[model samples]
Target: MDFRGRTVIELGAGTGIVGILAALLGGDVTITDLPMALDQIRENVRRNAAAVAAAAGRARVRALAWGRELSSFPRGYDVVLGADVVYEPRCFPALLATLRHLCGPRSVAFLSCGMRRELGAGRFFDTLLPPHFHVELLRRHDDTDVSLYRLTQQHDDTNVSL
Candidate 1:
């Protein structure tokens, strides 16, 4: 997607590579992760500062644990991104809550996951997410067993279980 001049947020950003790339593509990106992970993300952001500046984009690191302090994060980002964030079933409720909070009526989310059956990836993709978002399969890399999905907030909020 064209991220130029758009506001983007990356959830569970580990080293902040994806958020940095989004910033490099001219997005005003906020890369968020747990408090313990902020140092690495900050380091990555610092490393890419020059490129992001040259692209006229902005990158910032923040500590955000899913479903905790939802009110602390501003609502309605233009794009929400998550990479390999669905591995833990115990975190599903929080993750879904975070997604719902971040996405507005016009907001879209792109989530990529390496489908590992042992990790309960299917339960999240097949059951948990469908009730709250309009899920669409954007692409599938067969060789890698990874799938990219595009999700938009469902219009009918009452149907959301979480």
Candidate 2:
């Protein structure tokens, strides 16, 4: 998608590669992860600073623990990105809460999940997510068993029980 001038936030960014690429595409991107992972993300962001600047895009790193201190983050982002973040079933509620808080009526989220059957990935996509967001399958990579999904907030009061 065209990311120029868009406000993007990436959750569970490991090395921040995705967010960096978004910035390089001219999006104002925020790459976030747990406190312990910030240094690695910051380092990667630094390595791509020149290219990001040339693209007239911005990338910033922040520490974000899902479902904690969410108020510190600004609401209504244009896009949200997450990769391999849905593995832990225990984290589903917090992750869902985080996604709900970050996304506004017009916001869209793109999540790339590496499907590990033992991890309950199917349950997350089928059950946990449908209540709060309208989920669509954007692409599937069978070789890698990774599926990319596009999600938009569901505004109906009947489905807002999350």
Candidate 3:
């Protein structure tokens, strides 16, 4: 996609690989993980900073607690990225809420996760979405499912193109 000048945030970045990919692809990206994952994020960021710098793309790692405060995040990002973030019954609501708060009116979120028996496909989306998103299942990677969503709050309509 055309992410050359877009500010992007990557959520649940296990090793910051997904965020790395976005940065490498020319998107301005910020990599976020829990406080415990800071080491991994730093290592990956350090290893790739030279390459990313040459590409004119920037990447940074910050501590993002999903079930907690979202006010720590800076505002105005064009895209929000997440990978393998579904499963916990208790954390699902907070996760989706964080997504909504981080992404502004005209933002697109790309979430990739392998839906398990626990994360029911029927009740896929949380009920808290702002009713202004277009969700699309991009493709299934082996047993993992990668989905993309276009979140636009300018209007109040949820249209899914199945």
Candidate 4:
């Protein structure tokens, strides 16, 4: 997709790989994770600063805990990225809430998940589909046991396409 001049954020950005790559592709990126993960994200951003500069893209690090106070994060992002974010059963509701808060009807979110039975991945999708969002499968990497999904907000008046 076109990243030029687009605003993007990555949720649960462990090492900030996705955000740094997005920055290198000319997106204005915010690489976010829990408060404890900020230092690592910052270091990754620092390591990729040259590429980000060369691409004329900007990247910043932020701390965002899902389902908590969300006033600090800006809304209406064109795209949101999440990699391996749906592992915890207890976090499903929080992550869903965060996704709804950040995405609009036209906004797109890419979520990558490892479908482990012990992680309660099915339960996450069951809660996500009805009242808040519509999801479409983007791709599945069998070797890595990962599935990527594209999500759009579910509007009262319209059906959202992925």
Off by over 4 Å in 1: 157-162
Candidate 1, residues 1-162, lDDT tens digits: the string is 689989999999999999999999999999999999999899889989999999999999998999999998889999999999988989999999999999998999999999888988878888998988999999999999999999998787566688
Would you list the rank order by lDDT, best first?
A: 2, 1, 4, 3
Write one digit per residue (lDDT tens) for candidate 2, span 106-146: 99999999988899998899999998899999899999999
Sum up the clashes in candidate 4. 0
Lowest-sum lDDT 10-residue window in model 2: 153-162
Query: Candidate 2 has what TM-score?
Result: 0.95
Give the Å shift of residue 108 in candidate 1. Answer: 0.7
For model 3, how does the per-residue alpha-carbon lDDT over 37-82 read when each residue is reduced to its tens digit?
Answer: 9898889989999888887788988888885778878665899888
The regions of model 3 sitting more than 4 angstroms off are 126-132, 141-154, 157-162
**Which is the leading candidate under TM-score?**
2
lDDT of each: 0.93, 0.94, 0.75, 0.86
My TM-score estimates for the predictions, one after another, are 0.94, 0.95, 0.83, 0.92
Point out the higher-scoring one by lDDT: 2 or 3: 2
TM value for model 3: 0.83
Instruction: Give candidate 4 regions above 4 Å deviation.
Output: 158-162
Residue clash pairs of candidate 3: none
